[model samples]
Target: MRVHVHPDRCIGAGLCVMSAPAVFDQNDDSGLVVLLDDSPAGADADHARKIAEHICPSKAIRITGG
Candidate 1:
């Protein structure tokens, strides 16, 4: 799957990082969402990414092509 994060829309909620640390992270300085793995492998990772996308308060995460 392909994942994308819109940093401009991020609100530093850190939900993505909490939900999918392997695929996402938060910048310590700016508190913005950081893309760790744009293309996460395996079903478990993909599921975690999806949870991140859904839980993001700012809806800054996007996933395409599962």
Candidate 2:
């Protein structure tokens, strides 16, 4: 699967990063969504996407190509 986050829609809540530290992170200063893996490997992809969708307050993270 391919995951993408719209930076413009991001609120810098840090929820996505908190939900999946291994898959998501934030910019130190800007605190914006930072995708750790655009094309995640194995089962981590689903998990990452799930957490991203759930944690994102703005719902900026989008998962495609399942």
Best by lDDT: 1
TM-score of 2: 0.84
lDDT of each: 0.85, 0.82
**How high is each candidate's TM-score?**
0.89, 0.84
Compose the digit string of candidate 1's lDDT tens values, residues 1-66: 789899999999888887888888889899999998888888646665659888989989988885
Off by over 4 Å in 1: none
Which ten contiguous residues of candidate 1 have the minimum total lDDT?
Answer: 41-50
CA displacement after TM-score superposition, residue 37 of candidate 2 (Å): 0.6
Candidate 2 — what's its lDDT? 0.82
Candidate 2, residue 19: the lDDT equals: 70
Write the residue-wise lDDT of candidate 2 on 1-66 in tens digits.
888889899999988887767678889989998888888876677677777677788987888887
